[model samples]
Target: MKTLLSLSIGALLAGSSLLSTSALAATHAPYTHTQFSITESVQPADILVVLVPENAGELRLAGWDRASRNHINRAIEVAGFDGKAGAQLEIVAPVGLSYGRLLLLGTGNPADLTRAKAETMGASLSTWVNGTKAESIHVNSQLIANAADNHRISAALAHGVELRNYRFDRYKSQPEARPSQRYSWQVALATDARSKFEQKQALAQGVFTARELTNLPGSDGYPEAFANYAKTVLEPLGVEVTILGPEEVKALGMGALYGVSQGSHMKAHLLVARWRGHDDAQPIALVGKGNSFDTGGYNLKTQAASILRMHTDKAGGAAVVGAVKALAGQKAPVHVVGVVPLSINMISGDAYLPGDVVTAGDGTTIEVGNTDAEGRLILADGIWYAREHLNARVIADIATLTGAKVGALGSAYSAIFTQDAAIEQSLRQAGELVQERVWPMPLDGYDGIVRSRIADKINTGSPGAQAGAIFLQHFAADTPWVHIDMAGEAFVSSASGIHPEGSTGHGVRLLTEWAKLYQAKQD
Candidate 1:
């Protein structure tokens, strides 16, 4: 019986592993490769030929085959090697041949190969190779450099590919199972640039760590669990982590947050993570609404099917965690604090209802107009807590807050509402740099929509649907704050760039880049 029980437990563990394969993959050891020199005397069977394209001549030669004494038209034609931006072509040959297959990747305008672009290209290559079944991939260096820095170009390209091939799929029962039927390819880089490529790989790992947290599931990513995860990921890097539970939150009169938690069975929490890279500088605080599962409470959601995915409502909080994770991983010299207000919004007899007046942490009474407008309530408490307690100089809060943002900005860019033009510009600049676009939204006429007759303010507009973003702006309360309404971009129905269909991990990259920029300014 004991043996049987052990076997059962093992099976359960295996099953759990399968369920969290992606999560496990997030921290997997990165693939490493030694660089090799490019040779003109090459056969057609190399898996990934890295060639230096000094001019159009080198580009033409990359298509040539020494064995056949002609351009490899068959491989080019059959493999679909179009030299367009972000496109790749793969050719498979017999196992005994020089490299077994050839991969032709597009690098647009060889002259414009900056390190960033090269890294992106390498990541794209890695992403492509990861999908294939090749056991070995070779990169020809002759097709990728300017005479000024041949070694740097080679290393950058390899670094990009290595970073791109990264996947966080460790929790699966079959660890080797591929989404597609492609085999894992071994990459060979130009020998001289291997060290530089390794450094870039480390940076990519840090970036990937941040991205994974943003993409995590809410079931396993509860407030306390997230706080613990942060401690695990950052404590080793010297960041300080503090978790404020229900008792402490209530003691502090964080009514806005507590009111929302009243409906949840799970206790609400506020996680504060501090990283003091500078001795005497005021820290930038990132506050996020970590609603684990938002059901709209007594103002119950009519869209049952859609609301089922409300677990992703914590995307904003995840972004904050993700940014801090990246910053810590990179050992970035920046003073920052991440404040996450975590809870779930459910319908219960004890839940705060419409027309109810609740005093916030700041002692401002808010009349609850709609239970669905719970994000702002929690955020109100969090933002105030950050300013009054943490003594933050700049505050930014991100939330999958309102459907009105979707109606306004769609799913591409988040609607950014900020009182400070400088903060708005910085966020916009960061968003643009990372491709996580944000559009500045006006707050001028939003106050009228949330003004309350029965109390200091209403949770939402009386009209019930329109101008929700504008209504949410009132909760910021004159702080130098930026509210990112990520309702549209938090989750999506399709895939893009580095994101899959479900949670886009939308704000992670945006906030990380913004934090970096903010840190640079401080320095």
Candidate 2:
């Protein structure tokens, strides 16, 4: 009932090739370009992108000559473009340009350049440039001096542009009435680090896959459906895929996950996808909480507003499926085992009550303080699956776990819970590089919070995030693990930057980069 969306893998060049006078190519463009069009390959560019950094007084047009620089500056002043970050000025028929139009892109400061900004700039470029009919546009990243920085910045920019060019109009009844994907055009971007483009493209594909899966309605993307998607896509890309049915999960003592699904019509599942890039090393474990739909079971979110957006509750599982797709497709030199426990927390005649006690995969009893707090129960089983079945050495689990986390961080960061130094540091570095930021919170001091009179632990407490993480820690035992609460960051209410108006695909980039970091350190 679901279809895999087409992904574009643009042409990659080794270095900058000479452009004719009509092409408006930069002399110092160090990167060889990849020719990619957002739509089909038949279109041509409508504009050209040139970046200018802001200095003390005037804009620093490093690559442009004096005459063209003055003309661009005059146009900026006339258009009130202050070279501010995300500011733009359009010029028609400038003094020295190959294309008829010019886009004055801004970088606040040269020294403060980051991958996040690069991605934003790239998205800004697509949002503005793709608004026009120009099919092919070029990016000039010549001003950046460091070859590696140039490569990262330029590739991130292109990746951003590619990300923003997405649309999920599958369920629209009047699909034709819905806006066609117009923010898609051919893009010619240059970067000296050619491999970075391949990697970034792979990462973008992962993000896109996650977004698409999350965007699907609950009726189309139940637990079994998601498992099928993994095998359909990842298996073809050389990833080993496994789907554990409710009986299989129950037989393995995944009581916590099974309890959450007993109320729903669809049976629960534990899906695993493995990429064995390095046979000699143990694969890093990635776990996701895949609650296809959270009706809150007995403690239901009866409010219309809360129930409407419950379809996105499975973002964490969608991300695991996506990351493996990218890594396997790219043939990344890393080993990864992605685990996702899929279930729908719905209300029914047999729905588990709020006060019900259940034993988990690790044989620990849990008092279900609130059925709405069900993400952690599934993740508990997932963590146990990673350790007992996969023999995980390092694990990271992502979920839309706690409303408290969103209240604390808004939509900016995922609340990270871990006590491991190396894993925490690597996650932080990866978050910064890819901009899916993780803010570490405490793992201890939760013993008294989730304490129950009868059961070993209760599911909810005053501080929901800490208690949820602590509950999961019981299953992880002594393994190095990190719990990421992505309640706010995984889905959005409006279009912004690289994210469209819906599913944000928040954890894909961070996990992909972290896998790369782990692979690098181990090798």
Query: Which one is best on lDDT?
Result: 2
Question: Candidate 1's residue-wise lDDT over 362-481, tens digit each?
Answer: 788899888888888888888888888988888888988877777777878888877787788889888876567899877665447777898877777733333455544455556577
Query: What lDDT score is found at residue 32 in candidate 1?
Result: 28
Estimated TM-score for each candidate: 0.79, 0.85
| Cα lDDT listed for each candidate | 0.63, 0.75
Candidate 2 lowest-lDDT run of ten: 23-32
lDDT by residue for model 2 (12-100), tens: 11111223312212122211122452321222235656665664255444445788878877877778776566667889877775667
Q: What's the residue-level lDDT of 315 in candidate 1?
A: 81
Q: Per model, state how many residue pairs clash.
A: 41, 10
> Candidate 2 at 348: error in angstroms?
1.4
Show pairs that collide, candidate 2.
15-32, 31-191, 31-192, 37-186, 44-135, 44-136, 45-135, 45-136, 46-134, 46-135
Deviation in angstroms for 448 in model 2?
A: 3.2
TM-score of model 2 (CA atoms): 0.85
